[model samples]
Target: MFVSDSAAVRRPRIQSRAEATILHADLDSFYASVEQRDQRWLRGKPVLVGGGVVLAASYEAKAFGVRTPMNVGQALRLCPHAVVVPPRMSAYAAASEAVFAVFHDTTPLVEGISIDEAFLDVGGLRRISGEPVEIAHRLRAEIATKVGLPISVGIAGTKFLAKVASADAKPDGLRLVEPGRELDFLHPLPVQRLWGVGKVTAAALHANGITRIGQLAELGEPHLRAILGPAAARHLFALAWARDPRRVETGRRRRSIGAQRALGRRGRAPEEIAAYLDGLTDRLGRRLRAADRSCRTVVLRLRFDDFSRATRSHTLLEATDATASIRHAARLLLDTAQPLVTERGLTLIGLSLTNLDDAGPRQLTLPLEPRAENTLDATLDDLRRRFGSTAVTRAALLKTGEGLSVPLLPD
Candidate 1:
């Protein structure tokens, strides 16, 4: 319901400082917005993506108290009239690529936080692109005109404050935090509004009768440290004072690649579970090789019927992108946790490849023998790239369909 494409909201402009050139641009309910954008009937209606695990919810659905990762049963109970749709990861990726194209055109310095949001440095762009707020408003307009999706933008002196301002301007709105008033804008928010403050940290702060950012600032670094250890206290206190020195950076690749599958409460056999793991490993290996990267650690994650979670991991002797190598380590980790899986009844299973490194050329042996699996990997990848992902599927996944291919930042 926000002014998605309206230029009227640009009134009452706030003064800008040289330091307030960072802009945080975020898509409004990215996946759900994509759905609504594509289907006219879904516009202004409660829509939910991923029935099993609420991947994304439209603003209309959120108004009914439907939060993502919530079970569909609870979400439906919250709003029985809400429409459910399966995820179209391909569509989301296409949209992301389009949006990123816009981002790159906007500024050379773009730090992508995810597929849907990024921080842009617009300090030097004042003469070319007008003020930071003007650039943000035009950026939103261009995206709406070109991509037919809503976005929110925030302008501030620091990355932390910029990101927080973006959240406040949801569903196609824009906000700017002027200099000298950063504390005035930041201190009134809840303690959890700080970057790294999660449920556990928030609970700790609440136990100490602190709920707002101003209270945390007034508590003093020494007292805050006593409440939340030294490292966390230092980080939160700095954030409380709106002190973040990070600048927008480009070409920063992810340190890890991961994917997860959510299964209904119905029990799954060990082989069936193994099949799911195989599909996940295959897809992840393909993604790693596609990104031209390698990983040295395989992590296995699980969520049980009781909603309890567990994680197991194995480190490899060397980094490799081969599906077989990654799957071997993943299977080993899963095998070690077999007892827990059996006891707890797994409802969700996931795999993460960590300790990632660029897949640079390696030294050849004296005989100059090449790995046959490497050729096989290249061949399969070529085929899939030429055709579609379904062109080459593992025999193990014939009965068990390939798990969902969720969208992610470039690998």
Candidate 2:
């Protein structure tokens, strides 16, 4: 395990530019940790959330080689004594909200990457908040005291390094990468530590004996471009030198809204796939409406049992956040991909609404007749909002006995 001193430490100055002000604060094993926090018996024990697939695994479970997105069967086989718990989304959301409240109080420039992680910029608060390390320590203490969760913080000069530092300080710790020691801290890590270095990219780099970030840096941009193409080569090369220039963007509008379901290794019938699509579309539509946004494009993504994937997309004439419209477009895309689905067994299906825009006040005109579909949509949305998401579901879903929609973090 990578370890760093919780107390601030200074290194030999290699660069004399800016102070390490960016902080990446990430909650440890968010969902599983929440389960352990609420239930006293679950403390210090391996915990798995979700039964069909692993949504989150505690550090204890992870020690047994269990991971998220793995099939529950495999996870259980690895850690048979692990406790399995269904997701409590409302409780998690409440905990997330409380933690974010603390983040906003610490700094106005907060960029939320997910429900459990954020990048906070605290550059100009020396007089008010002591120093970056001090601020991070207090933030971690506040969350533990108030929200009852353990969060690790990484302080660095750039967002990328800060994120990396926090990840290295896993399972409840704090790390600060001083400005000059960035390369000293980054170079020894594996190539997989770099962002965008997934399985395929790692394999490509490993084929050339470039397994470490320092090795890749020694290859230079030209050789990297020859191996990994221009765009990826340029990005990775710059990161090897710690040249991230992105800022923490506040109130960043989502570029797309998407949801995906894991179907395990079993073959799914067309109707079953459609039912899953319906659930995803309904949930996404509700989210779009809640955010006052509309989309012009619908995308369908599929993963086969052979570990290969394909994507299909459809663009509509007008932007819409209506569940019926989105579902219709999605169904059409699915129909076009039916041949491929049959040829290759599908293991996952996902839908995304892209080309988003602010859905300004829709023009209203008196209609000659009551539009039943529109009325039904309005009624269902209101009912779900008032009661719960399960207040009103489609007849098809009811007949199929499909499980409750799996909870997802906000897109």
Report the C-alpha displacement of residue 214, candidate 1, in angstroms. Answer: 0.9
- Name the weakest run of 10 consecutive residues (lDDT summed) in model 2: 1-10
Q: In lDDT terms, which candidate is top?
A: 1
The backbone clash count of each candidate, in order, is 0, 0
TM-score result, candidate 2: 0.91
Assess every candidate by TM-score: 0.92, 0.91
The whole-model C-alpha lDDT of candidate 2 against the native structure comes to 0.86
Tell me the spans in candidate 2 whose CA falls farther than 4 Å from its real position: 1-17, 361-374, 399-411
Error of 1 at 292 (Å): 1.0
Cα lDDT of model 1 by residue, 218-332, tens digit: 6777778888999999999888877787777788899998998998899988988988998899889889999989898999999999989999999987778898899889888
